[model samples]
Structure formats: structure tokens, C-alpha cells
Target: MTCKALREGGAQVLAWDDNPDTRINAQSDGVALTDLDRADWSEVRALIVSPGVPLTHPEPHRLVRLAREKNVPVIGDIELFAQAMAALPAERRPSIVGITGTNGKSTTTALIGHILKKAGRDVRVGGNIGEAILGLSPPRAKTVFVIELSSYQLDLVQTLRCDIAIWLNLTPDHLDRHGDMAGYKAAKFRIFSNQTSEDAAIVGVDDDHSAGVMTRLKASQRQSVVAVSSGRSLGHGVYALGGKVFDALGRSPRAILDLKEAVSLPGAHNAQNIAAAYAACIRLGLLPEGIADAIRSFPGLAHRLELVGTHKGVRYVNDSKATNAEATAKALASYNHIYWIAGGRKKEGGIGALAPFFPRIEKAYLIGEAADEFAATLSGTVPNEVAGTLETALDLAARDAAAGARDTPVILLSPACASFDQFRDFEHRGDMFRTLVRARIGNA
Candidate 1:
């Protein structure tokens, strides 16, 4: 898309990929193929690299180093879109809401866009979830762009400024890409950069890193900042506690919504998502009651604690998106008497960090490359079996959960590892899990 846009702007596009197959595909799509190694670096305007490509990790890509040497700005697709938006007339440009964090970013981005759409506003949502930023319709004055940004995308962004910026809680993730936790936090912090005093910033203060960000932002007073929390009541912000959502931005707290009946949104992580979404929309001038109404009716994102079906008195959930221990912890806490199916390509800390939630799992069915490691993590704490493959794990979990003593034994697939060991991606893994569950125990 970036290449197409650049070519459409009358620039002679030169594209290359390390993989010969990728180069062939690009050439077939009308992108002029060039051997970047032999191409003149001085003639290039800018090098638009994918977010996945390392700018400076174990070692920066050779092209990146060359681009740097030639003083060519290396950026990602998000940055390219931002530059395009900047070129547009100010009065005709759209307002943007940028969301970033280690978790809950997708949910919050979708929730904010959903609320705006329900309020009869012209809204387009993309960037890091459903579609690429450049693939969305051209921005108009009345149109609002709600974007979910990853840390990698954030690193390449410079001039982009969101009218409403939201930073949800952060945890250790993609450390190899960013180098360390501090570097990771710095990348997430870029969401608040380039903001003006007129703009608004909504931050989740539940985690230590996020709380520190809120404190620093408050101290600077550069933007209209609001602190949101799902665990406790704050003096002046949106908060959720005891299944009730509160608007505490006044002299007294006011209840706006209740999540006790929101089946799609379960657990405190979602509560934080709701609080952030509510605060952002309210700041953007949407009515509190309208926001609450939209949130109530909004169908949640799939593959994140998605309730597949209930069969034979057992419930099935597909949370394949939880590719880290922190995310898996949230899913584990949302249910009791859980028949957990976990394991995949291992992560840094493995499942050792989830030791606290072991008591809630009635039994665990492990699979993929991380099975042995996960089994060791749960050895004396939670009863576990190395099922080796997702197919076998799902079958075992379904049968065991059905025969369990608990009235509503929940069979959950919240693997705390990447799906690359056995599947293409998290979505593929989730689809297979859903298919298996439906075949084994007919969908409700």
C-alpha cells in the first residue's frame, strides 16, 4: 500500500525484499523491483521499512544502515500516512485518536470507534487491527480516525499527533525488538508525543509504568490529561470498580454504566479498556450516556476471551490472542474450574509468571513446543498433561471438562506463547480451536 501510494504521488517506486518470492509478488503487483544493494541511496527520498524489520537490534538491517548513512529518514507505513495527512489542508483534515499499550489496545481502539459510530459520527478504524492505515478511505473534516499503534510503529512516527491519545497499561513484550523494558516503555510513550495543550491524553494508572507516565504528564501539564483506573476510585477521572463504571470528573462520583451484564467484556482488563474508551470519547465531546449505551450493545472482538459455545454443561472459550503470560493471567482470572489448553512457541519468562493462577485451573492440557516447559511450570501446583499438539489437547480438554464435577467447567484455549510453532498466527490457531470445539461439542 505504501509503495502504491508513493507511486501514485508520481515518485518512481523501487521495491526489493530479501525473499525472492516477496520480490516476485511485488513486481507482479506493478511495484518496480530493484536490487536495493545496487540502487543509488542518494536519490531516495525516504526508506519506508516495515515495522517488523529491525532498525537497531542485535544489528540494524543493511538497508537501514545505508539509509542512515545517506541521511534518508527510515519510517513505517503509519509515518507515511501521517505525512500525507499533514499535507492536507488543516480545515479539511480529520481528527485522530491513537491508542497504544502492551495489552487492551485493540479492544480500546475498537470500543472508542464503536462508541463514535453509535453516536452517528463519521468514523474509520484501522492502523493495527483490521486494516492498514493507507487502505482506509481518505480523511475528511468530519471523519475521525481511530488507530491502534504497536510499539514498533510508534518508534517510526515523528510528526504525527493524535487529537486524543490513550496509553493503556504496559508490560514486558517484544523486548527483543526494543532491547529492554525501558526502551519498550519509551516507544509506548510516543503516543503522547507531538500533542498540544488543546489535545487530550487518557492513561491507565493501574500499572507502575503507566502511573509514572501519568505523574510526569500531570507535572508537565502540557496536555489535558485524565487518569483512568479499573481497580479503584480516583478523585478526578473515569473509573470502574465493583462492576460499576463511574464518572468522577466532578465534585462527586456519578455511575455511568454497569458491566455485570456485559457478557462480552469480562475481567478487570476489559474494565480498564472501558474506562479508557469512555474517557476518550467524553473528551472528544460525546455524551456520557450515549457512550455507555454504545458500549453496552457493542459486540466484542473475537479470539480474546471469546465465548465459543456451551455444550454438555461445559463452556468453551478461545483466547488465542493471549500470546504472553500477562494476557493469559487475565483470562485465567476471569473463570474458575478452568480446563486450560496452553503452550506454543515459548516466550521469555515462559508460564512461570502465571504461578499464582494455577489453583484456579482444574487441569491443564499442554501442546506444541512449549509443552514440556509449561508442564514443568505446573508440575506440583496445577495438574497438567503434555498433549503435544493442539488437536489432541483440545479433544482431551473437551472430554475432561465435560466429565468434571463442576457444573460449568470452562475449557479455555489461552496459550501464553506465540502460535508460530504450529500455526500461521494467533488468528489461525483461534480458528482451528473454534472449529475443533464445534466438531467435538456442537455449538450452542
Candidate 2:
């Protein structure tokens, strides 16, 4: 999309990929393919690389090295979009709401866009969620671009200067791409880099890392910072407490909305997401009443605690997007008497940290490469079975859930690991789970 956009904008794009198939696809898309090794260095203006391409890591991509050696700026698609926005007339460029966090970024971005759309405003959502930012319709007046940016994209952005920027909870993720936690935190901090006092900076204060970010931004006095939290009551800013959203933006803290009736938003994690979205919308001049209405009707993101189906009294949920321990923990906290399905390409800590939540699980059906590790962690703590494949696991879990006397037995697919071991990605794994659940429940 970036290449095509650049070409459409009249910039001569020279595209290259290490993979032959990718190069072939780019060539087929009307891109002017160039051999990076042999191309004249002086002719190149800048190198636009994918977010997955490392600038500094296990090793920098050869293209990155070449670009640096030639003193050409190396950037991602987001930066290109920023440049395009800058070229447009001030009145023509759209207002941007840039959101980044280890978790809840996508949900918060979608919620903000949904609220704006419900309010009859022109809004486009992309970036690290569905479509690429460059692929979205060109910025227009009153069009608010609510984008979920990854740390990788954030690192490459130089002048995005979003009208409103949100930093949700920060957890250890993509540490391999960035050298360490400090490097990852620095990348996230870049979301607030170019903001002025006129812009709003909404920061989540639940995690120490994010709280530190809020503290630093407040001290800098570069922008008006609004602290958001799911756990505690903030002296100012917005907070979610006891299943209700409170707006303490100015004078006294007042309840804006009650989330007890919101079926899609189930857990405390989502409460944090809702709080951030509400705060951001309010900052952008949205009325609390309208924002609350939009949130109430939100269908919720697919594969993130998505309720797939119900059979008898048992519920099947596809939380396949929870490809880490922390995410799985959130899903677990929302339900009791769980028929949990977990395992895949394990992350660093495996499922060791989730030991506390094991008591809630009625039984665990493990699959994929990390099954043994997860089983060992659950040994003696929770009853578990190694059901090698997803199909087998689903069958066993479904049967067990049906036999259980629990009032609400949830068949949850919150694998605390990546899906690359037995599936293409988390989405593919999730889709498969959703399909299986539908078929089983439909047959039942």
C-alpha cells in the first residue's frame, strides 16, 4: 500500500524485498523494482522499510545499513503518511488520534473511531489493526484518523504530531526488535514527541512504565496530560472504578457511564480500554453521553475474548489474539469454571506467571509446541490434558464442558503463546477455533 501510494503521489518508487515472491508481487503491482545491492545510492531519496525489518537488532537489514551509509532517512509507511499529510493544505489534512500500548491499543482505537462515527463525524481507522494507514482514504477536513501504532511504527515516525495521542499500558513485548525494555519504552514515548500544549496527551497510569510516561510528560509541560486508570481514582483525569467510567477532567469527579450492562466489554482490562477511549473522545470535544452510547453498542474486536457460541449452558470464546501470558490472564480473570484451551509457540515466561488463575479453570486442554511446558506449569495446580491438535482439544473441552455441572462453563482459547508452531498466525488459529465452535454448537 505504501509503495502504491508513493507511486500514485508521483514519487518514483524503487521497491525491493529479500523474498523473491514479495519482489514479484511488488513488480506485478506496477512498482519499479530495483536491486538494492546494485542500485545507485545517490539516486535514492529515502528507504521505506516494513515495521518487521530491523533497523538495529539481531542484525540490521542490509537495506537499512545501505540507507544509513548513504545518509538517506530510513522510515516506515507511517512516516510517509505524515509527510503526505504535511504536504496537504492545513485545512485539508485530517486530525489524527495516535494510540500505542502493549495491549488494548486496538480496542481503544476502534472504540474512539466508533464513537466519532456514531456522532456522525467522518472517521477512518487503520494502522496496526486492519488496513495500513497509507491505504486509508486521503486525509480530509473533519476526518479523524484514529490509528493503532505499534512500537516499531512509532520508532520510525518523525513528525506525526497527532492532535490527540494515547499511551495505554506498557508490558514487555517486541523486546527482540528493540534491544531491551528501555529501548521499547523509548519507542512508545516517541508517540508524545512532537505534541504541543494545544494537543492532548492521554496516558494510562495502571502500569508503572506508563505511569512514568505520564509523569515525564507532565513534567515536560509540552502538552496537557490526562491520566487514565482502571484500578485507582485519579485526583484528575478519567478513571474506571466499580464498573463505571468517571470523568474528573475539570472540577469534581462525576460518573459518566455504567458498564455493568456492556456485554462485549467483560473484564477490568477492557475497563481500562474504555476509560482511555472515553478520555480521548472527551478531549476531542465529544460529549460523555454520546461516547457512552457508542461504547454500549460496541460489538467488540474479534478473537479478543470473542464469544463464539453457546451450547446447552456452556460458552465457547475465541481469545486467540491473547498470544501472551498477560493477555490470557485478562481473559481468565473474566470467567470462572473455565474449560481453557492453551498452548502454541511459547513466549519468554511461558504460562508460569498465570499460576494464580489456575484455580478458576475446571480443566485445561493444551495443544501446539508449548503444551508440555504449560502442562508442567499446571501440574497439581489444575487438571489438564495434552490434546496435541486444536480440533482434538476443542472436542475434548466441549465434551467436558457439557458434562460439567458448572452454571457457565466457558471454553476459552486464550493461548499464552504465538501460533506459528501449528498455524500461520493468531488470526488463522482464531478463525479455525471459531469455525470449530460454530460447527460443534450447531450440531449440538
Candidate 3:
């Protein structure tokens, strides 16, 4: 999409990739046969690399080294889109709202986009949340672009200055791609690196790392920063105090809406997401009434905490997108008694960090490569068994939950690992779970 957008905007596009089966190759005007050994860069303006392209972390891709040697700038799709947006008329151009964090970025991005669309704004959501930003059609004059940016996307951005930049909360994630925690943070900070006084910066100051970043932003006297805290009352930001979303930027903090009233937005973490979205909408001139209505009507995204079906008194949740320990932790925290179906290709830390939440697991059915390690970790803490695959795990969890051993039993497929071990991606793994669940539990 980025290549297509660049081409449409009169920039000659030259796409190069080691993989010949890429969609971009079919759409591009010209394709270059690229490999680590190839060093031809005479005809290219800039090397527009994918965010998935490793630049500096886990050893930079050879192309990055080649670009550095040739003095040709290496940028990402977002950077190109930013430049394109600048070339268009100001009012005609789409307003961009960027959401970034370790967790809840997808939910936050989708929530904000849903609200704007409900309020009659043309909104297109893409970026790290699966949709390619450039592939999305140009929004109407009143359209708003809500993008969910990962640390990698933010790292490659040069001039992609968001009109409203939201920092949810930075946790230790993607360290392998960013070198270390500090390096990972540096990439996240890039979202606000180019913002000016005119732009709005919305941040969640609940976590210490994000709070530290907020402090630094304030010290620099950079831009208009709105801080949000779900933990306590923040003096100059939005907060969830006593189940109400409040804006604390004025002399007297004003109540936005009751947290319970926001139906689609649930959980303490979601409260933070709501607050940040509300703050950004308000800053962008959206009426409080419209924001409130949007929050009430928005249905949440799928495969996160999506309720698949209720069968035999057990509620099945498809949270296949919980591809990390932190994400699974949030899903686990949402439910009191969970028949957790977890395990896939293991990440660096394994499931060791989730030890604290073991008591909540009534019984964990493990699957894929990380099954043994996860079972070993939960040995004495929680009752667990290796189901070998997702199909077997689903059957075991459903049968166990149906036994009526515990009240309000919820069968949750919140794998705290990647899906590539047994499935193509998280969505495919989730679909398989849904298919198997529907086959077994739907009749019950």
C-alpha cells in the first residue's frame, strides 16, 4: 500500500525484497532482485523498508548496512505517508491519531476509530493492528486516520507527525528487536519526537516508565501533553476516579462520563484506553456528547476478549491475539475463574512472568511448543495438563468447565505465545479454536 500510495503520488517506486511472492512486487512499477550480496542502490531515492525489517536490533539487516554505506536514507511506509500528507491541502488532508503501547494499543486504536465513525467522521484504522495503512482508501475531507503503531513502526518514522499522539503504557516488550528496555523505549519515544506545540500528546502515566517519559516531555517544554492515570488522580491529565472518566487539565477537573456507561470499553486497562481516547477527541474539537455516545455504541474487536459463545453454562473467549505474557495477564485478570488454554511457540521469557496469576487458573490446558515449559512453571502452582494441540486443549477445557466444578467457569484461549508454531498466525489459531469450540460446545 505504501508503494502504491507513493506511486500514485508521482514518486517512482522501486520495491526490492528477497521473497518473490510478495504482493508489493506485483503492484510495484519495478522490482529489484535483492539479497544480502546485492549492493545496487544507484536508481533509488530512499529505501522504504518494512517495520518487520530489522534495522538495528538483533543485528541489523544487511540492506540497512548497505543503505548506511551508500548514504541513502532508510525509512518506513509511515514516513512516506507523512510526506505525502504534507503535500496535500491542510483541510483536505486526513487527521492522524496514533496509538502506541505494549498492550491495549489495538483496543485503544479500534475504540477511538469506532467513536469517530459513530460521530459521522470518515475513519480508517490500520498499521500494526493488521491493516496496511497505505492500502486503506483515502478518507473523506472530514475523515480521521486512527493508526495503531508498534515500536518498530515508530522506529522507522521520520516525518510522520501525528496530530494526536497517544502513548498508552510502555512495558518491556520486543526487546529482541530493540536491543534492550532502554532501546525499546527510545523507539516508542519517536512517536512524539517530531510533535510541536500545535499538536496534542496524550499519555498514560500509570506505569513508571511511561510516567518517566511524561516527566521528560514536560521538562523539555515540548508540546501540549495530556496525562491520564487509571491508578490515581493526576493534576493535569485525564483519570478514572471512582468509575468515572475525568479530565483534570483545567482549574477544576471535569467529569467526562461514567466508566460503567461505556459498554464496549471494559476492565481497568480499558478505562485508561477510554480516558486517552476521550482526551484526544476533546483536544481535536469533538463534542463531549458525541464522544459519550460513541463510547456507548462501539462493539469491541474480535479475538481479544471476544465472547465466542455460551454453551453448557461456560463462556468461551477467543483471545488468540494475546501473543505475549503481558497481554495474557490482562485477559486472565478480567475473568475470576478461567480454564486457561495457553501455549504456542515460546517467546524469550516464557510464562515465568505470569506466575502471580496462577491461582486464578482453575486448570490450564497447554498446547504447541511452549506447553512443556508452561506446564513445568505451573507444576505446583496450578493444575495443568498438556493437551498436545489446540483441538485437544479446547475439548479438555470445555469438558472440564462443563463438569460444574466451579461457578461461572470461563474457557479462555489466551495463549501467551506466538501462533506460528501450530498455526499461520493468531487469527488462524483463534479461528481454529472457534471452529473446534462450535463443533463440540455449540450442540451442548
Candidate 4:
């Protein structure tokens, strides 16, 4: 996508991929393929790399290091998009809203885009979500690009200053890619870079890392900070307390929306997402009542507490986006009498933090590499079994839930582990689960 877009934008594009198939595919698009290690430095404008390519910690990739020695700026597709926007006159440049964190970024990014598009704004949502940043339509007057940026993308972005930047809650993730929590935090905070006094910074204060970032941004006064929270009522900014969104950015706090009515926006985690989206839309001059109505109408993103189907007396939820303990915790907290199906490629700390929610699970069917380990964790505390695979896990869970006593048993696939072991990604895992559930439940 980056290569094709850059080509169409009239830049001389040279690209390479480690995968031969990918190289052949890009070559088919008229993109020139060259060995970066042997390419001439004089003719190269910049070294743009994918977010997966190592740019910093664990030592830079050879190509990245080589590019640095040759004085070529290394950047990602996002920086290119930024440069494209910058080329336009100030008034013509489209507004950009950047969102990042260990979780909730996708939901928040999509929610903001949905609200904008519903309000008739030309919104292009990409970056770490749907299409590549350059793959989206060119920026024009009133165009809003709602981007979900990963830490890796943020690391490669240098001059992409967002009109409004949102930093959601952060947790320990991609430790190998980032080195440690401190390094991870640094990458997440890069979303706030190059902002001026005119921009608005939306920071989620529910987590320590994000809260500390909010403090730093507050002290810097580089831009306006709209502190968001889901745990407690804030004296200022936006927050959700007692299941309602509160706008405390004024002299007195005012209730914005009753979250209970928003069927798709459930649980505290989603409340945080809603608060961030609400704060951002308001900053973009959206009316409060209109914003609330738009939020209520949001259909919610897939693979995050998505209700796939219902069977007999049971409901099936595919929360395959919960690829870590912190993320899974949110899903677990949102439901009860759960016939939980968990386990995949094991993550650090296991599912130990989820012990508090064990009582809510009627039974757990574990799968993939983490099955035995998770079974051991839940041995005496929670009724669990190593179902070995998602198919068996779902079959067993569904059978059990159908016979269970609960009025509405929920078979939840909120695996607190990465999906690389048994599937391509969280999306694939969720898709597989959705397909399996639909076969039995038939979309009821």
C-alpha cells in the first residue's frame, strides 16, 4: 500500500520485502525492487520501513543502520502522510487525530471515525487499523484522519504532529520489541510530539503510564490537555462515573450521556474509549448532544466483546482482541456466568491477575500452548479443562453452557494470550470462533 500510494503521489519509489512473494507482488505494481544494502545513497530520498522492522532497541536492523550512516532519514508510511499534509497550505491541511496504547486504541480510533463520518465529515481511518495511511484518499478541506498508531509506528514518525492526540491506558506489551516498560512508555508518549499550543491532547488517566504522561503534558502547556478517566469522576476534562459520561471541562460538570443506553459501549474499558472519543469530537467542534447520539448509535468494533450469536439459553461473545491479561480482564469483568475459552501462545505473568474473576466463570476450556499452564493456574480455584484446541473448547463450552443452570450463560473467547500459536492473528481467531458459533447458533 505504501509503495503504490507513494508511486501514485509521483515519488520515485524503491521497495524490498524479506518475503519473496511480497517483493514479487509489489514489483507487479511497478514498484522497483532494489537491495537496500547495495543501493546508492545519493539517489535515495528516505528509508521508509514497516513498523515490524526494528528501528531502535534490540539494535536497529542492518538496513536501518545503513540508512542512518548514509544520512537518509528513516520513517514509516505515517511520516510520509504527514509530509503530504505539510505540503498543502496550512488552511487546506486536514485535521489529524492520533490514538495509541497497549489496548483500546482500535475501538477508540474506530469510534471517533464513526462519529465523524456520521456527522458527514470526510474521515479516513487507518495507520494500525484498516488500510495503510497512504492508501486512504488524499486530504482536503474538512478531512479528518483518525489514526490508530502502534508504538512501532510512533517510533518511526518524526514530523507527524496531530491536531488532537489521544493516549489511552498502557500496559506491559511487546517487551522484546520495546526492551521494558520505560521504553514502551516512551514510544507511546511519542504521540504527543511536535504539538503546539493550538492542538488538544487527550490522555487517559486510568493507568499510571498514561496518567504520568498527562501530568507531563499538563506541565509542558504545549497544548490543551483533556484528561479522561473511567474509574472516577474528574474535576475537569471528561470522565465516566456511575455509568454516565460527565463533561467537567467547564465551571460545573454536566452529564453528557447515559452509557447504559449505548448497547455496544459496555464496561469501564469501553467507557474510557467513549470518553476519549467524546473529548476529541467536542474539540473538533461537534455538539455535545449530537456526539452523544452518535456514540449511542455506534455498532462497536469486532473481536472486542462482540456478540456473535445466541444458542438456546446461551450467548457467545468473541473478544479475540483481548490478547493479554489486562485486556482479557476488561472482558471478564463485563460478563458473568461465563463459559470461558482461553489460552493461546502464553504471555508474561500468565492469567494470574484474572484470578479475581474466576468465580464468574462457570467453567473454562483452555486451548493452545498456554492450556496446561492456565489449567494449573485455575486448578482448584476455577473449574477448568485443557480442551487442546478452539474447536474442542467451543464444543465443550457450548455443550456445558446449554446444560448449565444460569439463565443466560455466556461462552466467551477472550484468550489472554497471543494467537500466533493457533491462528494468524486475533482477527483470524475471532473470525474462526464467529464462524463456528454461527454454524451452531445460526445468528440467533
lDDT at 80, model 2: 87
Q: For residues 59-160, what per-residue lDDT tens digits would candidate 2 score against the true structure?
A: 898889989999999999999888888788878978889999998888898889889999998999999999999899876687899999999999898888
* lDDT for 367 (candidate 3): 95
What is candidate 1's CA lDDT for residue 386?
94
Task: List the candidates ranked by TM-score, beginning with the highest.
Answer: 2, 1, 4, 3
Please give each candidate's TM-score. Answer: 0.98, 0.98, 0.94, 0.97
Ranking by lDDT: 4, 1, 2, 3
> On residues 13-69, what C-alpha lDDT tens digit does candidate 4 reach at each position?
777888899888877877789877777789898999999998776879999998998
Which stretches of model 1 miss by more than 4 angstroms? none
Per-residue lDDT of model 1, residues 1-444, tens digit only: 888888777888788899889888898988888888899887898888988899887679999999999999999889988888878888988899999989999999999999999998999999989989988988767789999999999999988889999999989999999899998999889888889998999999999999999999999888998999989999999999988999998799999998875678999999999999999898888998899899998888889999998887888899999999999999998999999999999899998888888889999999999998889878888988999988899888877887787977999999999999999999999999988988876543
Q: Provide the lowest-lDDT 10-residue window in model 2.
A: 25-34
Q: Which prediction has the highest lDDT against the true structure? A: 4
In the range 134-200, model 3's lDDT, one tens digit per residue, is: 8888766877889999999898888888889999998778888999999999999899977888888
CA lDDT of every candidate? 0.90, 0.90, 0.85, 0.91
Q: Judge candidate 3 against the unseen true structure and give its global Cα lDDT, from 0 to 1.
A: 0.85
Instruction: Report model 2's TM-score to 2 decimal places.
Output: 0.98
**How well does candidate 4 match the true structure in TM-score terms?**
0.97
Clashes of each: 0, 0, 0, 0
For candidate 1, give the lDDT of residue 176: 94
lDDT of 3 at 153: 88
